[model samples]
Target: MKTDRIMWGIVLLFIGGVLLLENFNIIEFYWGRVWRFWPIFLIIGGVNILFTKNKSQIAGIISIAILVITLGILFYKGQQPRQKEVTISSHTEESNDLDIPRDVTYSHPYTDSASVKTILNISGGGTSFDLKGSTDSLIIADVQRKLGNFSLETNKTDSITSVSFKMKGKSKWNMGEGGNDVDLKLNANPIWEVHMNMGAGEVDFDLSGFKVREFNFDGGAAALNIKFGDLLPITDVNIKTGVADVKINVPVASGCRIKTKTGLSSKDFTGFTKLEEGLYESPNYKTAVKKIFVNLDGGLSNFEVKRY
Candidate 1:
């Protein structure tokens, strides 16, 4: 009985840590998806109690192993990327309903300008989004949505260009007939500070061609695959994830340093030297002129960093 209680206590503490990270935007948990597996907890507890009553030590060990395997599968599934087909439709506002078009596609073309710094803010609720580098001199975007009022607002002041996207109103999370999606391609010439808040879904980000000064990403119940190609003199990258799998690829020549704080997550820093607990540095980190600093806080997620 004592052993069972201790095991349950440990389980509860693990769950509490995951929840705390979720609240801080370091992780996102969708109860609806995993609620069905709630019985697993009860089963584990029941098996543990049975072992205590019978004094079957092997049974207790088996129960714990089963629980671990189940949780591992759940984590693996959560990190898998999901694909959705979303088409771009013409924008038309008829009547006051803000009725969403079936193929509502908006393209913002790029025009050559003297802007040197780009500030981008991305906010979406339950939307699948894609981001990549653009060949044109101007930052371009093609946004498509099936429901809610989607807005792409931009501003420019001197050499700084600011762009923001939001799915306005409470209906942002409402997935109507076809679903919601945002596909963005931006010019990679200017220096950038990209801030992204993804409510849910999958994000595929490729920053290979852009000179990123600072990249901040916060996600909830999402899968992220990010590749960093080029970086600024002093690059700062901060990422927080919840109930997701995050994989980052760094350039071969760039010096990289990673610091992490995690809860119930597996971390793999391939080819990096572990200076100490929770600190990792690349081979050329000290000698390279350009450096990339990565700080990651994760909850109930899997994180991996690799050099390409």
Candidate 2:
């Protein structure tokens, strides 16, 4: 059998097994956690291609076994009962290292002011998120939750700074309700790249007071409201969600264009001119000195865009 075919067969088998286990209540698999491991499949395919030639069925069988074992280990660990809840910090891969002493406020500043770029990665799994601009420091992150439920990670380099928020415990789908709550302030001086991955919650991002170069939001069954601030240094904004309701505000003076790709969803962009089926442009988009471009993709969602 061809290596590509063998690899795909193994992948299908693994997915089928996972679904079977899920059906039998033997394991509850979170695809988000396992999605990062996709690169391993490429490696497996490469190994199969190299070794499974000239009727070498042993190589293909070994490759399939390896994948099965890997997935088995993941499911086994996920099903283990922790002495306490397990929180995975975005800053580190080791989940057992989180030790939250009490229900206290935690703060971390950008250690070096010389860093020109800041990337804020907030994984607000089933939580409420509120973020705005701040001049108090390079970045200020504040998270409030039950003790031992969440943790923060900060990493700084000469050219970049990164901060992440991660949660612990059994997380359920957030359907417009509560989970981890976060309030963060970001410095205006450095170029900012903000990425949020959230689930079943509400997100309010008042970014009009900050200087942001790029922003990306990904959510699962959530509600998102964003207000753009003055001096948007970046031109591109991207958002993807599943079963979400979204509203966005763009500064009136900023020329803006919106392109939406969705499935069975509704959009209200009243003031903008529709250039095509799913593309829109502001009145001054061609003449304005600075412009904003937005791209959205999702399914069964509500989207609205307004000029403020």
Best by TM-score: 1
Query: Candidate 1: misplaced stretches above 4 Å?
Result: 1-101, 107-115, 135-137, 170-179
Q: What's the true lDDT of residue 12 in model 1? A: 55
For model 1, residues 17-43, the per-residue Cα lDDT tens digits are: 554565457856543244224456678
The lDDT of each candidate is 0.68, 0.67
How much is the lDDT of residue 122 in candidate 1?
80
Model 2 per-residue lDDT tens digits across residues 175-278: 21124456767776767788877666667888887667788988776668888765853467898987566788989888999999987666778799999988
Off by over 4 Å in 2: 1-102, 111-115, 132-135, 146-148, 172-178
